[model samples]
Target chain A: MKRVTLFVGHYGSGKSNLAVNYALMLRSCGKPAALADMDIVNPYFRSADSARELEDAGVRVIALPFANTNVDLPALPSAIYGLVESRSEYAVLDVGGDDRGALALGRFVPYILEENDYEVLYVVNFYRPLTGNANDALEVMREIETAAGIRCTGIVNDSNLGGETAPSDIEATVPLARELAALSGLPLVFTAYDARLPRPDVPGPFPLTLQRRPV
Target chain B: MGNKVLMKGNEAIAEAAIRSGCRHYLGYPITPQTELAAYMAKRMPKIGGVFLQAESEIAAINMVYGVAATGRRVMTSSSSPGISLKQEGISYIAGSDLPCLIVNVQRGGPGLGGIQPSQSDYFQATKGGGHGDYHLIVVAPSSVQEMAQLTGLAFDLAEKYRMPAMLLADGTVGQMMEPVELPDEKDVEFTEKDWAVTGTKMQRPHHIVNSLYLVPDELERKNFERFERYRRIQETEARYESFLMDDAEICVVAFGIAARVSKNAVLAARAEGLKVGMIRPITLWPFPSQALKEAADRVKGFVSVELSMGQMIEDIKLAISCRKPVELVNRAGGMIMSPDEVLAGIRKMNGGDNQ
Candidate 1:
């Protein structure tokens, strides 16, 4: 596993959910884990929303300075530098949505590329409106890469309809995920699904618990 | 749920607007409603439509007015403060009888309040926010699916009535993701507007689109004609949903996110043997008044749940002619009411206030 991991892709594509889960999983496995939230495009449903839970479980949460504030200023916290510079063994950075969102991640591109031990997983869901097919999904993935100035290492198929997702729904997206992986030349790293549902047949099943929203 | 796609409420409205044959979109960035413009920016140019990120909310709305005059479907969206800026344009559009969709994904505010979900704009939306006499056919969507479906309906109703229409949403619904089956693109058809100010090309008399009348009697007659259209809309277009109301004695009226929260309270109250039901108004302007009026006879009392200081309660009172006491269950300043608070409000209706 890479020391520095990033989750980026289309909006509403479950990037924050996967980032939070990956950090928690690393913490649960007794590794020194730190989570950084770099999203500025959305005001709600942020990984920072679960800062308390992440902090309580021994995972260092470098949350947004303006987490619960009303203002929509694109204020990036200085603490975000810890995502690349922190002494934690595993650092998971949750980038914002799409190309506009990936622009925030570009600042760390040189440092991350120099480190050369990082992984940028392009997390995608075929069920999201903008990226329903492999061709459309590839275009978005390329847009994110260009905007972020980094190439994707792998693909995570986090495809399912929220609350209405069944095992069949998870299974239905496998072919689309494979097609995206083939087109983008990125390996199929894993397929994420709701942990409550029984794990369906997919390569590298990464069961996920939904993110806790801010109270 | 056929071939369902997951989408945020803001994005859903954008896609559904495009599918509804709206080719011109003008909006400025504002939280909770920013994604709507972002989606339009990405999709509009690819489809040969006009998508402008105007310098100001006022500018965007006036551009919407320009597009509407040419008899093409047009829209502009903003949050609370931005919506306030567009009020004058909305009134102008209504006065001119030009059809357009103006969306307000509301946040807390008297002036630049928090970017959290709020229904505080109820009074501004239902009553006239702009000057003079007019109503923008307003609709409130509780879920992302309705956000998509109602966007299409809003454009249809605006064209049919030849006035401005609004989708009154809040931050919660505007930001939440839900599975939705969008309308097929092939079905979107735009009808001809004989009243449009399209250039004559030396063919016939020019059709003028204007709200200004130099004479008082002429302006008065225009106002009367607009009111007649409003009267017909009020009679024929009031839509709402009734939940667990057939056997309930205590009626709860809410809309948008508050209504979604109230539904859970209604379910929990029903489980505890409390005869509580909910009336969710789909149309806030043509406010499903007859439903509440009908429910008033059977229901013992009413509870109006909201994210504002009881704005919708005013409509509830008028809808039922104040025959029953309408208590308020609300939280203001960007706070959301939980199911427990709403259940407590329901309990008060049951007996807490009796003795």
Candidate 2:
């Protein structure tokens, strides 16, 4: 089964960064990766905005005909169906920010879940709303599942995007992630480098898988 | 045996959450929803559960984030204004795919509109309360008993999908009292969280949970995958209740309290010998358009009866594909239309259609 990775987050929560980085990592590892831009929510930060950058890196960018709109983006291209058919090494889907973008999740659930095996990694930023706590985060997961009709496969605590983020913020959020893991029944998948961060004095047998990426 | 109790919609949700194995409750008090917070606060500590009245809606949702991260069932309740405050948080939660329940005892909105029974927030709850490209498992309850049942389902669905689920009740549903037999607490498998960061503890690996992705291409991938899940939701989870729709010549499309009122209107219209029926959307987010489409094929026309000024009418029109005339019966800004008033609209439409 081809490994399809989906990068999801709220607006300005750093979903795009992770999607791009992961795609790059996959390509550099000599794996062919296809990146599809399906974010009809926020048109500004879409992967199509940096189409050249992805193309330069040798990743196939699935482009939409018109600029994305909040209410009225054209139905997602049929190419998405073709790509899922390809069964590439990694197919990256960069979703829009928040629940409204989740509406777009409606268009694709049938094709993807039935066709290609996909991993939905709900990335969280502790500083972000809804995800700042364990309980609320679980609610977010449920909403997505109800809206998208697919169960969450994993969780990514890529809690920072820019300046002013501290290791303590990550420390403070660890327990929340533990609870999220227990609730969703999925493992907490994270970067291996995070182990160097100052550990919290919390207890856990967190279901986590470490992914080592080139920084 | 758990205690059987009669309670208001708001209080029943509080009681039902406790019965459903939810031990954590966090929320700030808002009008019409104040009772729910009070009930949770009163009951949480007694049962060794946790309840905190946060300083603001943002704080409350963030606290929900904190507790949900622990992999426990939890919930928050608010009226329109407070729900507005929590929208940012709701979006973040949707983005991160967290499982929690959000109860909205809706009041008039577009900014602190009113304290009366209103369904004005129907669009917000069913559409998207938060700023992200996301959707809540928005369930609009028609009765106080349903308020209890849906709240428990909200928690179950929330955990099931790893997404936010909302129990949408109007002020009427929240405040109205009714007899209810809350379900027995059965052992539910809160499984599938082998991926959550309960804590590394030197066991497997360090885990991170976030909605932030700085890469453009990667974000696109994520959004598309979320779309995949939404499609599945549309296919399997869309729910609505149809009353006398199969053989009726005319249909009323409504939800929540409006559906209840429309039921009376449909019956009265039938008494007057007008073939009328109703389609009530229980899952407002999924918006049982398919049912309406099927109904539209049978009915000559449709009337979208809502508490707001035609908010849901657009959906009815779209669903019917404009095959026939779509009329609207609505009252806005906390005013509710009586069954007689709704019947009048149906009569007028029928009167015109027949000629």
Candidate 3:
């Protein structure tokens, strides 16, 4: 697993949900995991909104001061810097959705780039209108990378229909995920699924406990 | 024209705007409606159109005003709070009688409420949101296909009436995916505006697009003329859909996402030998009062199902004129009213002897 995993995707693509689940997944494997909630664009369904659950699971959570508040300011808490610099086994950055949201990630590009051990995972949900197809997903990936000043190292197929997700839904997106992987020249690292659902045949299928609902 | 593509409601609205000859889109990023702006940003440049991300919602609506004054089919979209910020500009557009499209993918709010889908903005959208004696031609779409179709209709109505039109959608419709048969790109001919601010190259008098009138009488005349246009709109442009109302004893009135839920509940109630039906108001500003008044004579009672705490109920009562009792089935603050909850409400109304 990459030490520093940055999860980026469009809104309602389940990035924050997966980020929170991934943090707990890492800790369950005995790896010290810390999560940085860099999503200042969306006020709901963010990793910061699930900070209590994540912290209860023994995972460190870093969130903005005004997170989950009605104050829609884009002020990132300074604690994010300290969280990133600490000697944790794994650090997950739950980025905001889309290019405009990814602008917040630009400030940490220098530190992230200097580390040289970070991986940006572009979470793709075939259900989302903007990233529904391979071409659209690729376009969104390019836009996010351009805005964040970083290259996406892999794709995480997080295709879902919120709580209505079925196994067919997971199976249906495998081909699009593969096409997106080929078009973007990035690896399909994993397919995010509910842990309670029957896993598909795809390799590296990451089962996640559904923590957050779609915003 | 037969191609069906799965699409989100927000993206469908954007594509429909493009196909309807909208060349200018200015908006700020807000959840539940951001996909519309993002879709426009990607496709507008390819089509040689302008998609500008403004500094704020206030700026975006003002930009719409500028683009509308140029006689171009332009649009701006935002969620509830952002739409609140654009009220001043919306009023200005209304006063100037400029045609434009504004989409509100509504979230919960009295303040910066939760980002979940809600019908709390019905009063704001149907009633004048901005401070003025004005009315936005409000179209409420119930599905993804309607999201696209009503967008085309919104532009057509806006241009036809020489007034602003609003596509009032909730977060559920904005985010949900459904197969939609998109409209073909047509060569839409906009109504030639003799009052547009196109530069006068010595062919005619200079056209000025301003809302200000220092004289009280002139301002009153403008208001009267605008109200006259609104009267025409109310006369001819009211739109609504009736489902299973012929033999329905209990009629549920709703619009947008709430109507979608009400349809399911109505069907489920009918399955158990209860007579339930739905009246979906497609045009909220015109209110569909005539249809409701006609339905009130036939149906036993009315039940209003909405995502807000009874905002549309007052209009329902006013439309029916207290001839029938109107019950409310709603969940406020971003909580969706489930079909089961609506079904229970239907049963409660069905068991009552008040009707």
Candidate 4:
């Protein structure tokens, strides 16, 4: 695993859920992980919305001061800069949903490049309207890369039918995920599935617990 | 016309707006409504139209005001919280009588509520959210296809009435996917904007677009004129869809996504030998009060089914003047009422014991 992993995807693509799961996975493996909620676009379903749960699991959560609050300002806290610069074992930046959301990532590109050990994975959920097909998914990826001033290193198939996801759903997305990887010239890093479901025999089937929204 | 393509409700609204001759769209990102902006970002530039990701919802609606002032069809969309921010601007548009479309893909809210679908904004949409004696022609679309069809109709109504029209939707309707046959591009001829601020160039008296009147009498006159327009709208523009209401003894009053669920419950009740039908108010502002009142006369009782805490029930009662008991079948704070729950409500209203 890379030291810094940035997750970016379209809205409703389950990027925030995957980011929380990835942070927990890293911490469970005895890594000092920190998940930064850099999503300023979406006001809900963000990693910051689950900050309490993540912190309870021993993951350092870096979120904006106004996150999950009534204030809708796009204000990022200064602590996020320091968190990004810190030498944590693993840092996950749960970025906002689309190119507009990924614009925040441009601010940390310099520090991320200085680290030289970061990976930006363009997460895709084929079930979403815009990213359902390979071409549209690639289009979304290119748009995000252009907006964030960074290219994605790999593709993560984090596709699922919300709480209704089954093992068959995970297996069915493998071919589409491979096609997306091949067309975008990005490696298929992992296929994320519900941890409770039976694991699929696909490459890098990462298991993730369903992260419920904080009350 | 395009072939039926599977599209999210948000994307369909965007495409439909483009086909309806909307040349300008300004919006800030908000979940359940962000896809509309994203879709516009991709297609607007290609079609030589303007798609601006404004600094905030306040800025986006103000941009709509600017674009609408020039007699161009323009729109802005947001979810609940964002819609609240745009209320002041929407009021300004209505007071000025500038034609524009504002879409609210509502989520739960009193403050920063959850991002799940909710119909809690019925009062906000139909009752003039911002401060003023004004009204927005509110249209509620239930299905993904209606999300497209109603968008075009929203632009038309806004233009026809010279008032802001809102396409009030919920998160479920905005996020869900369904096959939609997109409307063909309109061969529109630019309407004569004698009242527009497109610069007179010393040809005629410069048209000023202003929603202000310092004199109390002038302001009163403006309000009176606006109210007369609304009265006309109430008479001619109130739209609704009646499902199985020919012999309905129990009527379910609902709209938007809640109506979709209520339809299922209504059908289930009919299967169980209950004469339950549905009245879906498509135009929420010039609400179908007359139609609902007519239905109330025939039905034994009424059930207002919604994703909110019975916000629309008040309207139903007011429409019928409490002739029949109106029961609420609802779930608030983003919790959807299952068809079974609605069926139970219908059963209870049908003189059966409550579940």
Candidate 5:
């Protein structure tokens, strides 16, 4: 199968929950997306949480081995291998948060990108470490590249992590993201938020925010 | 749409990441994997993506942690030394049970060894690269096409297990050039906000992503829970590809580029009326031990071929458990085993045994 999307970011930047929502969004659109877990760095809140829920929603959840200690043995499932070799379209992988987690990509990126056709997105939140400024963000990118062995292709301005985040914050980070884009010669692909937005006119890339209506 | 282009294994991976919907790429420069970063630098922006050349292997992996926290499909690739720097982050990701893809287009070493492809990381991946108790889902690609295909699978499996997945490649696979078909872009669909903390909306609370469990019992519980997931993963992710094993007297086991060369040797041997078969491992972590054990029972002996001195050969021996004599045919420090070299080893083994 082909057409898999990977979600990556630094620790505490909120990629797991984002992965779940994004997978759900794709599912709502009548697409059969699969969620694969490749986060081998951080210690919590992974895509495995919604496995049954995603499976119930017709999204296949790639399962991982459980951990008894912080260092529990990694137990990868067989279907995972099958999926890597499968013919399905639209698989979503939620990578671990941090440059070290990114190191896991050392071997497969060549194969996945070439044979199956996948994409890698660097989720940049201005509030996090090494991404606090244009230079810091660039530094983070460099670190990720060092770990992954590939340069980042673009930036995602996901500049919020709860606690009274505002539209202005996202707006401010947009320029930084753009600046990073310019420096790296990569496009600021898209920006995302958990709340509603005013939809700014500064448009070179797509901006998306997560705002669910009240029940 | 046909984009059948000739490219080196490294650059090919960079291009494939874009097609696979990988938008965030991070990594530092390392031999064998450098072309991948150079390629991402030129291509990521043209299609709206982020390509960053990180400061160090440690920082790169931490950045991956940040971006991955946002629940995006991101990747980082490196060689052996760079991979070593990422071990701490890898341990954390495993403890936390996050899903991400790590590629190691391996080069030699214990420490800054050399710039040659080596399978020395076999134990690191299967046995756990860091100090903690975690196992990565390691996939070993023997060819350029497999490099791309396994990357896609690595993402899927990572998500499934909430664990780190590795694409274990060698310098030969990374530096070599080959013709490959890129995946179509029209098929990908992303829904990253489901569990990602894009700042808690008015509807939910803030999300916390970490690997630290300060409370002893709680941490213990978390560890056990993670083990449960790994247990399930083991039942599912073991993979291997076999060739001409049905009536063969000798079976060879190998992975990554070595397997490709061994396949050729097996064919050459078969042409000479020698009953030989080759077993190629696609996933090195959940090793196909059973398959090797079965082959050991049926074959007169097993030969493990690798670019390293004798890394994966140990696994073969452990799996076969002295059922049959397991021989080693290796080329270390940047040297590759030519078909003739491997065949020679096989012939010598046959002669020695027969005598």
Candidate 6:
């Protein structure tokens, strides 16, 4: 596993949910994990919404004050710097949605790039209307990469139709994900799906607990 | 071909509005409806549609009036306080007998309130937000898919009736994600606009579009004519979903995000051996009152589940004509009622232990 894992993608591409599950997965595997919510654009459902869950599992959570609030306080705390600098901790940064959101990750690029131990995972959803196809997904990915000032090392297919998601839905996105991987010249890392359901019949599937705040 | 894609509720509404041939989108940004405007800002320019970020909500609604006068599909969206800013323009649109769509993804408010979800704008939508002797066709959607579907429906109804239509939603439905199949552009059929102010080329009489009638008699005639159309709508357009209501003893009335929560609550209450069911109103203006009136005959009582402080409760009571007792289950100022809370309301209405 890479020392630093950053998830970046189009909005509603399931980045935050996967990021929360990833941190929990890392901690369960007896690894020191930390998650930093960099989503300043979205008003709700950031990785920080699952802060209490991550903390309960012995994973460190870093987010701006009023992270889950309706207030659009786009301030990032200095605690996020500690996440990247710590050599012993496995850092997972949930970069906000789309190019607009990726702009927030700009200032941290130099530190992340120079370390040479980071893997920026460009999360793509084939079921999202705007970035549904491979070409559109690549264009969004390029824009996000430009805005964040970093290159994506791998592609994570995190496609699903929200609550109505079926295993077939995840399977149907395989070709699109592969095409995205081919066009972007990045390796297809994993396909994410709800872990509570039966495992999807796909290779390198990453099952997630589907992180959401208890309503 | 149906392509069901995952979409946030706000984005779904925007996409469906475009698919419904809405060519002009003018709006000022306000959460949690900001994504709807942002989606239009990105997609409209690419599709040969106009997406203008007006100076303010007032400016946006006036721009909507401009496009609407030209007999083209136009819309503007905002949250609660922002909607309040557009009321003057909305009243003007209604007074002029123009067709357009106004979307309110409601947030809690008497004022700025908060950005979180609230259905406090129910009275503002159905009763009197725009000060006038008129009604704007109001529809509320429970799911993300419904958000898209109802956007198309609202535009069609607005044009058909030559009136303004409001898609009254809340932050929960507007910001949440779900699998949705957006309406196809080819499938949307807009009504002809013979009353529009299109250029006559001096060969025919020019069409004049104005809301002003200095003569009281003329204004009163317009008001009477508009109410006649509203009567037809109230008779024919009231839409609602009856969930497990056939054998229900307790009918729960709700809409938008509240209906979704109430659905789960009704299901849970049923599982607990309570004869509770749900009536989710889709059209808030021509509210499914007659259906509730009919339900009142069979059901012993009614429960109104809402995110507001009992705004819709009054509507339910009036609908059933006080035929049966009606109780309220609500939370205000960005708070939402849980399925458990709604189930408790159902049980309490049932007099506990499955009365």
Candidate whose DockQ is highest:
6
TM-score per candidate: 0.97, 0.61, 0.79, 0.71, 0.61, 0.96
Q: Report chain A TM-scores, every model.
A: 0.96, 0.79, 0.94, 0.94, 0.81, 0.96
lDDT of 6 by residue, A1-215 (tens): 99899999999898999899889989999999999999888876788888898999999989878765665579988988777776679999999998999999988878887788999999988888889799999999999999999999999998888778889888888988999989999999999989876888875999988776534
- The CA lDDT of each predicted structure is 0.90, 0.74, 0.87, 0.87, 0.73, 0.89
Q: Which residue pairs clash in candidate 3?
A: none
Model 2 stretches with alpha carbons more than 4 Å out? A1-215, B1-4, B188-192, B353-355
Clashing pairs for model 1 are none
lDDT of 2 by residue, A1-215 (tens): 24788766544455666676667667778888888777765433456766676678898888775653323344577887777666754798887655656667666777677764788888766544335567766766676667666677877776532333345545556666777888889888762113434543433312222223111
Give the 10-residue window scoring lowest on summed lDDT in candidate 3 chain B. Answer: B1-10
Query: Which of the predicted structures, 3 or 4, would earn the higher DockQ when compared with the native?
Result: 3
The two-chain DockQ for each candidate, comma-separated, is 0.66, 0.01, 0.14, 0.09, 0.01, 0.66
- Over the stretch A61-159, how does candidate 1's per-residue lDDT look in tens digits? 877786776555687888767568653568899999999999999888887888788999999989887898999999999999999999999999998
Model 6 lDDT tens row, B258-292: 88888999999889888888899999999899999
Clashes of each: 0, 123, 0, 0, 183, 0
The predicted structure with the larger TM-score, 3 or 6, is 6
Q: What is the lDDT of candidate 1?
A: 0.90
Error of 2 at B231 (Å): 0.6
**Model number with the top TM-score:** 1
Candidate 4 residue lDDT tens string, A136-207: 899899999999999999999977765556677667778888998899888999998888889977789888
**Where's the lowest-lDDT run of ten residues in candidate 6 chain B?**
B184-193
Better of 4 and 5 by lDDT: 4
lDDT of 2: 0.74
- Tell me the tens digit of each residue's lDDT in model 5 across B14-112: 766677778889899887687678668766876788988888989888888777777777889999999999999889877767777888988878788
TM-score of 1: 0.97
lDDT of 4 by residue, B181-223 (tens): 7899996557769898888889999888898899999999999
| B1-355 per-residue lDDT for model 2 (tens digits) | 1133335577778888988988889999876777688767757887788989888999999888767776778788898899889888888887777889999888876687776667877778877867767888889899877888888888877887788899988887776545566777656445537657587779787656678888989878878888788778877888888898767999888888888888998999999889998888888877788888888778888888888877888878777888889888888877778888889889877864421
Error of 4 at B334 (Å): 2.0
